[model samples]
Target chain A: AQTIHQWPVAEIKAVGSPLSLGCTIKGKSSPNLYWYWQATGGTLQQLFYSITVGQVESVVQLNLSASRPKDDQFILSTEKLLLSHSGFYLCAWSLTHSQNTLYFGAGTRLSVL
Target chain B: GDQVEQSPSALSLHEGTGSALRCNFTTTMRAVQWFQQNSRGSLINLFYLASGTKENGRLKSTFNSKESYSTLHIRDAQLEDSGTYFCAAINTGNYKYVFGAGTRLKVIA
Candidate 1:
């Protein structure tokens, strides 16, 4: 079975500090990866997506970036953190870019202080 | 305007009762995915429909491309089924998905 793992289940960070979250997919080959964010009580927003290694697409501007360093690894990072960036981060994967079924990771909960 | 409009922003129901959630797309979409977010914020994929209908246990979902909408029916709803349901669509000519605001369902004993 396929599994997606996200690191640092929860984080409490200060404003202006650098932040990094990682996600790795196991048992899947070259799956489509995506990053999504949801505020405490807001809707889910797509931040970035990648179809292949070394290529990521930005769907929204949130002063954050995502990279696909390896076929099964996806990294989300920012030089600085903002209070507005505090939320739940989720990583999802699909068989193809257009495949309807998306398998999501456990997710990372971030609280910016 | 929202590309994907989901109805009943919030719903409350008694245990054993059931209801349906619906999503309407503004444009033709290639496919639709439904997800259930638990209290801990973990998302579980419920249904992925390209067209027609699919059923699993007490949940039944249908996607109508011609009507540009989809529906999720839950029968004999249980307390554990209470959660936020989200619908996302992949429109034609795009790899990104447009998501609905989500329908929050609450089941009370």
Candidate 2:
């Protein structure tokens, strides 16, 4: 069975501070990865996606960036946090070219004060 | 432009009753996935249909690619089933998925 892990389950940071959220995939190799954000009571928005190492695509420009440093590791970071950046972050993975099923991690709740 | 539209927006049902949630696609979609977002803010995958229909327990889902719509039927609704349900579609040539705003379902005892 494959599992996706995301951490710092929840974080509270000051404005203009750097932020980093990490995700790791187990039991799968070279799977497609995605990062999504859901504001308080808002719809889920696609933030970024990566197909392989050193390759990433931005879906929404919210001053946040993503990187695929390793095949099973994905990181979401920002140089400075904004008040609008507070929301729930989710990391998901799917089989290569098989987008029918996507497995999500536990998710991280970030609050920028 | 929003490629997916889910209907009812919100629904209230009594236990033992039933209802259906629908998703209409504006473009050709290769597959459809249904998910239930629980109170804890976790999304649980209900059904992933490439074509035709699939049923599990009290849940049944049907995907009609030609019609560009999919439906999820919930039978014998229980209080535990209360949550926001979302449907997403994958365009024929695109791997990215477009999600609906989600239909909030509240099951009353």
Candidate 3:
């Protein structure tokens, strides 16, 4: 079975602080990775997606960026955090681009103050 | 821009009762997926349909690409069924997903 793991289940950071969130997929190789953000009680917004290592696509520009360092590892980071950046961050994976049944991780809850 | 309009932004059902959640797309989509965001903030995949309908346990879902809409029906609701439900449709051109606002469901005893 495939499993997705996200780091730092929850975090509270001050504005202007650097932030880094990580996600890893186990038992699946070459899976499509995606980053999603959701505000409190709001719909999810796709942030970025990567089909392969070292290449990422940005869906919405929120001053955040993502990188795929390894086949199964994805990282989301920013030089500085903003108060509006606080929300839920989810990591998801799919078997392939055609098979888009996404499986999400537990997610990271961020609070920027 | 593609859009998904979900109906009944909120719903309440007594145990054993049932209800249906619907999503209407503004543009034709290639496929649709349904999810449940639980209290702990984990999104559980309920269904992924390219067309037709599918059922599992007490949950059933249908997606019609030609009509540009989808629906999820939950029967015999239980306490664990209470959560926020979302419908997301994939764009045929880019395969990027457009999500609905969501339907918050509460099951009361």
Candidate 4:
């Protein structure tokens, strides 16, 4: 069975503060990783996706960056946070890019004040 | 305009009752997925369909690529079914998913 883990279940940070969120997948090799953000009472939006290590693709520009440091690890970070950046961050993985089923992690709740 | 449009933004149902949620796409879609965001803010994958229909327990979903739409039907609804349900459609060429605003369902006894 495969499991995805996200760090710091929830966090409250001030505006302009640095932020880093991490996600790690276990029991799967070379899985496609993706980052999604959802605002309160809003739909989810894809932020970035990675097909392999050191290769990341940005879907929407929100002043955030993602990196796949290891085969099973993905990191989302930013130098400064804005009030608009607060939302729920989710990490998902798929076996393949086409006709793939996405599995999501527990998610991390962020609050930027 | 949004590529995907979901209807009935909110629904209230009594236990054991049933209802359906639908998502319509403005463009051709290769596939569609359904998810349930529980109270804890976790997204639970419900179904992924390229075409045809699938059923599991009280949940049944259908994806009609030709029609550019998808539907999720929940029968014998229970209290645990209360949550926000979302539908995501994957574009034909890019494979990028566009999500719906979600329908908030609340099951009352």
| TM-scores, all models, native as reference | 0.97, 0.97, 0.98, 0.97
Among the numbered candidates, top TM-score falls to: 3
lDDT of 3 at A13: 100
- Sum up the clashes in candidate 3: 0
RMSD to true structure for each model, in Å = 1.3, 1.1, 0.8, 1.2
Q: On a 0 to 100 scale, what is the lDDT of residue B42 in model 3?
A: 93
| Best-matching candidate per lDDT | 3
> What is each candidate's DockQ, to 2 decimals?
0.75, 0.64, 0.84, 0.82
For candidate 2, the TM-score is 0.97
What order do candidates take by DockQ, descending? 3, 4, 1, 2
Q: What TM-score does chain A of each model score against the native chain A?
A: 0.96, 0.97, 0.98, 0.97
Clashing pairs in 3: none
Off by over 4 Å in 3: none
lDDT of 4 at A67: 96
C-alpha positional error of residue B55 in candidate 4 after TM-score superposition, expressed in Å:
0.6
- Residue range A1-113, candidate 2, lDDT tens digits: 89889998999999999999999999999898999999988778889988889999998899999999999999999999999999999998888875558778889999999
The sequence of per-residue lDDT tens digits that candidate 4 reaches over residues A1-113 is 99999998999999999999999999999999999999999999999999899999999999999999999999999999999999999999988657678889999999999
Show the lowest summed lDDT stretch of 10 residues, model 4 chain B.
B89-98
Order of the predicted models by lDDT, top scorer first = 3, 4, 1, 2
Candidate 2: tens digits of C-alpha lDDT, residues B12-77: 999999999999999888999999998878989999989999999999999999999999999999
Candidate chain B TM-scores, in order: 0.96, 0.97, 0.98, 0.96
Report, to 2 decimal places, the DockQ of model 2. 0.64
What does the lDDT read for residue A42 in candidate 3? Answer: 98
